[model samples]
Structure formats: structure tokens, C-alpha cells
Target chain A: MQPSSQMLKGILEGAILQIIQQGDIYGYALHEKLAALGFGDIPEGTIYPLLLKLQRNKLIIGVRRPTGNGPDRKYYHLTDEGEKTLTIFQQQWHQLVQAMTNLNQGDESS
Target chain B: MQPSSQMLKGILEGAILQIIQQGDIYGYALHEKLAALGFGDIPEGTIYPLLLKLQRNKLIIGVRRPTGNGPDRKYYHLTDEGEKTLTIFQQQWHQLVQAMTNLNQGDESS
Candidate 1:
């Protein structure tokens, strides 16, 4: 199951950064790859805007690649900043998980 | 280390709800518990506003209880809707973790 919009709100950017970090990918193609990886149905509206925002923030950069059949595709690639962000995201995520584990286990005793 | 504000924005509400669900707690006490649980240094300004918003949304309700030594403590509890939200949050969280795991693993193979 996919997350609620609210849940996805904070997480999607990091996920997208991670995806782009793996390799450069275009906007539409990202959805397919995200779905294949089990993120479920992500809307183009959400993806494009976040991509623009990431570029504005210097976390990612888009390179226009020519396609014979269509307009040039803006393929996104992660910047070093984005890689650092992903590392922080991973650490924070695991910390939250561990803390939650402690909290849940503490339920029995407290 | 704590998550970035952007990362925590969507998650704090559900975490607060889960905390309240586990036990009736006041705003200040919630922080101590949250920090203890390793959510890191969450500020009072953030918690109070969220508590008010949750109450406004009817997900949580606060009851003022008398404390002999101090002002009344408004303790929070979850509504039926809040419980359902918590369940969904748990499922969504697990789904996200699993999906992220898949995405990362795919990197090695693809």
C-alpha cells in the first residue's frame, strides 16, 4: 500500500533524490521506476514540481537530453548535496525506527 | 541526529498521536518522552500548535486535570478516528520501509 499524501509529503523528496542518485532519469519514466520499486502510484504533478524545487535548492540538476521522436527530456541527476541529504535521511530514519521500537517495548513496562 | 524540519513536518502529528495513544500525556511531558524515545529535541512551539490543530480536527481531545502543586495540566487522548489514523500510519510506515529496501536492493542488480 502507498502512503497518505501527508506521509509521502516529507518522504517523497528523499526517495526521488535516492532514485536520481542511482542514475539520471526523466520525469515520466521516474513514476514507472518508482512503482516498480514499490513506491506505488506517484503523480506527475507531485514529481515534476519537486524536481524543480530540488533543482532550485541545488540538490539536483537537470540535463536536457535530445530525443529524435520528441522534445528534449530533462533528465535529473543528484548533486553532492543531495547525496549528503540522502545519507542524513537514512540515519534519521533508522534512529526514528529504533526510538519507536523502544517506545513500543516500553509500553509493556510503563 | 534529528531529521530535517522538512522531513519531520509530515511525521510529527502521527508520532504525537501515537504517543498520546500509548498514554495520556501533556505537551511538555510529551517532549521528554519523545526525546527519551530518540525522536530528538522537538520544541514546545511545534508540539503545542500541533496539539491544538489535532484537537481542532477532532483527532485528539484534551482534558484539564488538577495538579496540587501547579496549574492544571491538559492531558491528551486519541479519538476513535485517531486510532484508525494510527493504524494506517503504522501500515504506511512499514510499506515505505519495505519499498525503500526494495529500491536500494534493485540498485545492486540493475
Candidate 2:
């Protein structure tokens, strides 16, 4: 389901953090990842603004790198703070998943 | 790890969509979910803006209800469009997770 905007905003950072924890990546690559997942129509404009916010918060750092396939790309990597945040996010994600699963199980039983 | 701003923005909607797919919830409840996942320090200001954007995109709808413990709360639910979006997101999320896991495995092997 399309999550409410409020919920979307709440989890955006953690999701992104988890993605980056996998490896260094750029905006377009991240967009492609989202597209592959079924969010093809997501508004491109919204992303840049949120990117700026993450940078300002010091959760990530960026570097410009030349790509063989395209122009120079800005690659973002997680900082120490970012990793810590991701740890927290992952924990929360697991907790939320467990909670929801239990909730669903309750519904099924009742 | 904290994800770059760019990546965070790209994935935010999808994560939120997944959460809502689990059940209807409110902003505070959603925030708590994020917090439980380790995003306790997220900025409060950012969520409302994203919620507005999600509403504008028509992926979610909202209702106001009185709470016994507090004032009126705005509850948001996924629309059909939102559900479709979440399906896409979940697929994408799985793909991303698979890709990352493979990448990590490759790194470990090498």
C-alpha cells in the first residue's frame, strides 16, 4: 500500500541508510533501485530536497566521481554517525516487523 | 549506517508504503515505529512535510478522530493506489536486498 506521507517521511532516512550500508552509491543508482522495486512514478523533485536534509544532518557525506557510463556522479557514503543511525533503524525495523506480524497473527486468530 | 540524503529520499515513499500495507496508522504511531527501528532522533519537522506531499500525490487519505489519551489524531490509511505502490515497493525492496546481499557475499568471498 502507498504509505501515508507522514509514515513515508518517518522511515525514509532509515531505509536509505540501510541501502547505503550495502555500498557507496549515487542518486541515479538509488533511483534505479527504487524503480526496480515498483516506485517508478515517484516524484524526482522530492528526492533532492531530502538529500540536502540528510547531508545537513551529517548522516552522510558525498563525493563526485566520474562514471564510465555517464557524466560525473556524486556518490554518497555513510559516515560513522550514519552507521550508528542505521543500526538503530535496523533494530526499529525488526521490532516494527515483529510487532506487526504479531498484530496480524492476532487478527487471524480472532 | 546513515544513508545519503539522495538515497533516503528515493526510498522513503516505498518504506512508508510497506508500513501502511501492514495496517492503518497515524503520524505519531508511524514515528514511534521508526523510533523503535532506531530512528529516534529524526527531525519532527520533516515528517509533516512529507505527509503533505504523500496526500497531494493521492497515495493516501486521512481521517481525524478523538483519542481518549489525548486530543484529536489524524489517522492515515492506504488508498488502492497506495497499495499498488507498496506492492511495487516491496518488490523493489526485495531486489535491493538481494542485490546488496550478493554484493556483500562477493566482498566476503574475495
The candidate scoring highest on lDDT is 1
lDDT of 2 by residue, A1-110 (tens): 22333333455556566667788878777766644443343455755566667888899888998878879988888989999977766555544444434333433221
Q: Which runs in model 2 stand beyond 4 Å of their true positions?
A: A1-110, B1-8, B107-110
The per-residue C-alpha lDDT of model 2 at residue B21 equals 68
On residues A48-110, what C-alpha lDDT tens digit does candidate 1 reach at each position? 998999999999999999999888899999888989977776666566666666666764221
Candidate with best TM-score = 1
Q: Write the per-residue lDDT of candidate 2 for residues B1-110, one digit (tens) a residue.
A: 12333333455556555566677777777776654443333455766676767888899887889988888888888889888866665555554444444333433221
Local distance difference test, per candidate? 0.75, 0.60
Q: Which ten residues in a row have the lowest lDDT in candidate 1 chain B?
A: B1-10
Among incorrect, acceptable, medium and high, the docking class of model 1 is acceptable
Model 1 residue B54 CA deviation (Å) reads 1.6
Using DockQ, give the best candidate's number.
1
C-alpha DockQ for predicted model 1: 0.25
